[model samples]
Target: MFDINGGELIVLFVVAALVIGPQRLPAYAEQLAVLVRRGREWISQARTRLDEETGDLGVDWEALDPRKYDPRRIVRDALLDEPSTARRAAASAVVGIPPAASAPLVGPAPYDDEAT
Candidate 1:
């Protein structure tokens, strides 16, 4: 997340080594690792607590998941409700793209061995 490249990491290491000194660098590095681990644990605990509190209020956690923003899911949900012809025609007027002649089939097509 910090986006530190190899060169940046080397620079950070050199600075830490110079400032902290070679004699104590390993000990300091170990301490830093432990601090980071503890911080992560605290964050996870906070997230769990928040989720539990929100769950009491009946939130749908799956909908909050960022990975669920799949294009297929979005388009499928939008198409499930059949809009009237007037709405469909007006939609293109706002966006300036021609409406489809017809909606495409939502799922897998029938096998066509003849095409293969």
Candidate 2:
């Protein structure tokens, strides 16, 4: 994220080595590793808690993958929940669409210059 390249990394290592000294570098590295491990454990615990809460609500926690945590995916899934007429009517109401229309009115579209 910081965009540190190989040269910058080498410089950072040199600076760290100098400031921390050779003897204390290993100790500091070990402490840093421990902190990273603890942070990961905390994240895992939080995820587990979230999973439990979702499961209690009858949600499939396994279906909720972190990599697929896109707002578009959530919206699409909500929209495609049911193919039945009654469910579609309910969905249309939720989305502020009139049940008589096949598509929702979203205001006038811009004229396509290339179409002519």
lDDT of 2: 0.84
Model 1, 4-37: lDDT tens digits are 9999999988997999998998898899999999
Q: List candidate 2 segments past 4 Å from native.
A: 56-116
Q: What is the TM-score of each candidate against the true structure?
A: 0.47, 0.47
In order, the Cα lDDT scores of the candidates are 0.83, 0.84
Give per-residue CA lDDT, model 2, range 1-116, as digits (tens): 99989999999999999999999999999999999999999999999999888777777666797876889978878665646788768888998878887344355657888996
Which 10-residue window in model 1 sums to the lowest lDDT? 101-110
lDDT of 1 at 72: 88
TM-score, cand. 2 vs. native = 0.47
